[model samples]
Target: MNQLKVELIVDNRVNRSTLSGNGIRNAVSLQPVLYVGGIPNNNHINLTGSGLNAYGFQGCLSSFIVDGRLLDYQRALVLN
Candidate 1:
């Protein structure tokens, strides 16, 4: 009983996010994007930390789907 589901759908100018856990579902719509990025070739991306992830997010994601593709999340990364 320790599972949570989060879904974010971006359409046009609005962003809709839904969170469901513990048999309850909640949804919200906002204008700001859920994911933020820096301008291309600009050096002031993370000005607070000098190009570093100073205000980034690090969390545990068991699995996620992108463009109908399912990804199994893990801590360790392998390069081939």
Candidate 2:
């Protein structure tokens, strides 16, 4: 399998429920949901990004999520 590099830039204003990634928003669930062409294993999916002015509703996400599930990763970061 080949590797896929996904990039996201979420510039959010107004505190409403929405999921913004690479400039896409769901406007409902408020979680980032990325859809690829084929069904890829969650373990194979690698997520990396940054956020600011963010206070988590679930007390800050220590791990990235794929389809609303926590991902297994070596490290997690929150940059201001």
TM-score of each: 0.28, 0.19
Model 1: per-residue Cα lDDT at residue 19:
36
Which pairs of residues collide in model 1?
none
lDDT of 2 by residue, 1-80 (tens): 22223333234323333233442322122344432232235523222332222222333334454455675544332320
lDDT for each residue of candidate 1 in 1-80, tens digit (9 for 90 to 100): 32333444433244443333343311111122223232235323223312124354455444545557764334224421
Ten-residue segment with the worst summed lDDT in candidate 2?
A: 46-55
Candidate 1 is scored at a TM of 0.28
Instruction: Kindly give the stretch of ten consecutive residues in candidate 1 with the minimal lDDT sum.
Output: 25-34
